[model samples]
Target: MVGRPLPLRDLGFRSTMELVAEMPKVVRVCPNGKGSVVLKGEA
Candidate 1:
């Protein structure tokens, strides 16, 4: 294990777009701006 696991609320996220859209405004203020990632769920 490395970083603390993402919160369970994050695990239940439905779509990458939804996640990207839902990110806090402060986080989206990064110099690099909004980013996207694919979230895979356990079987």
Candidate 2:
């Protein structure tokens, strides 16, 4: 949340693991979760 919001389009062609690895320490991704992960906020 300290920087500009990452647009969904920027995530295109990237793998989930790639995104997860690039995420900040405060961001958590649950690859095993039952439902899709939702990103809440304006971009």
Error at 31, model 1, angstroms: 19
- Best-fitting candidate, scored by lDDT: 2
Residue 35 local lDDT, model 2 = 66
- Position 36, candidate 1: lDDT: 40
- Per-residue CA lDDT of model 1 for 1-43, tens digit only, reads 3687545466676654456556655234233344644433323
lDDT of each: 0.49, 0.55
Candidate 2: tens digits of C-alpha lDDT, residues 1-43: 4697645457673565566556656456554576676433333
How far residue 21's Cα lies from its native spot in candidate 1, in Å, is: 1.3
Q: After the best TM-score superposition of candidate 1, give how far the Cα of residue 3 lies from its true spot, in angstroms.
A: 16
